[model samples]
Target: MKKEIKKIVSYSSFLALILMSVLACSSSEDSSSEEADSDDGEEAVTELHAAFAAFNSDAVTAILSDDGTEVYIETTGYPDHTSVYWETDNALYIDEPDVSKTTQDTYIGGGQGEAASFTVDATPDLTGATVATQLNTIGIAVSGASIFNDQEGAGDLDQAAGSLDWAGAHKGPGVYHYHLEPTPITSDDDSLVGILLDGVFIYGRQCNYTGGTPTDLDASGGHTSVTQYTDGVEEYHYHIINEVYAAGNYAYQPAYVLFAGPFQGY
Candidate 1:
C-alpha cells in the first residue's frame, strides 16, 4: 500500500547559514558533530519501506510524517481473513466449533472495534538502550490487526490459549489481536509479518537471507541481515522466535511467539 505523504516546509526567519572559511574550520568540529547526531538524531527517510506493500490494503494505510522522520500507521482493525471473532452477520465471519471465543457476546467491531493509529520513527534509534514492549498493541500485523506480547492480563497467556482461533488470535475483551504466530499472515516460512512500535519489520520463523532459522538473534529475536525487501542490503529486523510456546489445546499446538521483546530498534 502506498503511504499518504505529509509534506512540511520550514519558514524559519534565520534562513541563511554562514559558511566558515577552510583555514578557520577545525577537523574536530565535524567529527564531534557527526558523532553527536549519530547518537541521538532521528534520521529522515524519503519513502516507506517496500515490504509495507504486503499489508492488507483494504484495512490499513500508512501516512508518512510531514518531516519525513516518521510513519503513521492507521488500520480499521478488521482483518481480511475469516475468524470466529467477527459478528455472525459479517461476511468474513466463520464458525469454529472446536474453538472457544473470549465471549459469545463480544465480537469484532463491537464497541471500539479494532481501529488504531500510531507513529513510529522513520529510522529506528538503534543506538539507544533497548526498550521493553508494554501491554497494549506492540505492533500492527499484516492482516490489519494488532500484535500482542506473550502475556495476558498480569500473567502468561497459557490460561487463555484455548480461546484462540485457527489462526492463533482472539478478541480479548477489547480489540482483536494475535498472541501467537498468525498462520493467515505467516506459517513457518520467511514471510513478512508486520512492523513493530520501534519501526522495525518482523518476519516469520525463517530468515530470508539464510533460507532457514537465524541462529544469531539477540534476546529480541532480531539480527542484521538482508531481508527479501532490503534489495540485498543488510538491515536489522526481528523474526518470530523459533521456540514453541505450549499452551492448552491451542489449535496450532506448540505455537510460536510472534514477538516477546525488549525491542532493539527503539
Candidate 2:
C-alpha cells in the first residue's frame, strides 16, 4: 500500500509541472500578440490622416533632390533673400542683394497694372463674375496691383503661378499665406517653385526654414512658434522677423521636421 501511494504522488507532481509550463507559454504569446496589434493600429491612423498634416510629404519628396540647393526670399522688411546649399551636411550660404541695381524695365509696367485697372472697373457687378475671377481680382488688389520689375519672365516666378491651384485647393479660409517672389527648388534638369501653405517650409532631408514663426492671421495677426523634430534634430520655422531688426541679420535657429508616416523619425 505504501509503495502504491508513493507512485501515485510522483505521477501527480510530474503532471502539475507540465501544466505550469503550458500556461507560461500561453501568457507570453498573448502579450506579444497584443503589442503587435497596437503597433499596427498606430500605423493605420497615420495613413488615414496624413493629407491633413501641415506639410505634404509626397510633394516634398517630388520637389527636393539629393545634393540640391534652395533659395528662400525673406520679405520681412527689405525683401532680403538667403540661399542655403545641402551637400553632405546642411549649411547656410547667404546671398546679399545689391541695392545699387535698379528694377528691370521688362518686369515693370506690364499688362498686370492694366489688368488691375480693368478689374476695378469690372468690380461694379461682382455678382456676374465667377468666384475664381473675383478672388483673382481681390488678390491683385491686396498686392497693390504693382508690376514687379525684377520678376518678369523669370521661370521661377512662372512656376509659382502654376502652383496657385495647388495652394488654393489646400488653403483654409482666413489663412493668408503668400509668396510674392519665386522660391527656387534647384534641381539638375529643371528648377521648381511653389508657395508653402503654412508659414513653414521644408526642403527635403537636408534643411528646413520658416519666413516667420507660425501665426493665426485669419482672425488677427498673432504669433505662435512651431518646433519640429526629425532625425535627431530640432528646427524652428522661419518667417518675417520683426521689422526693427536688420533685413539680412534676422534671427534663425535650427528646428525639426514633423514627418508622419511609416518612417516617423526619418
Instruction: Give the alpha-carbon lDDT of every model.
Output: 0.86, 0.24
Against the true structure, candidate 1 reaches a TM-score of: 0.85
The regions of model 2 sitting more than 4 angstroms off are: 43-158, 162-266
1-266 per-residue lDDT for model 1 (tens digits): 12222221122212322223442355567877888987656789889889889999998899888778999999998888999989999998999988888889889999566887889998888988999888879999989999998888888888888898877889977889998999988889999999999999999999999999999999999999999898999999999999988666786577888888989886
| 10 residues in a row with least lDDT, candidate 1 | 5-14
Q: Specify the poorest-scoring 10-residue window by lDDT in model 2.
A: 257-266
Residue 122, candidate 1: Cα error in Å is: 1.0
Q: Give candidate 1 misplaced runs (Cα > 4 Å).
A: 1-40
Q: Estimate the TM-score of every prediction.
A: 0.85, 0.26
> Clashing residue pairs, candidate 1?
none
TM-score of structure candidate 2: 0.26
After TM-score superposition, what is the CA distance of residue 153 in candidate 1 from its true location, in Å?
Answer: 0.8
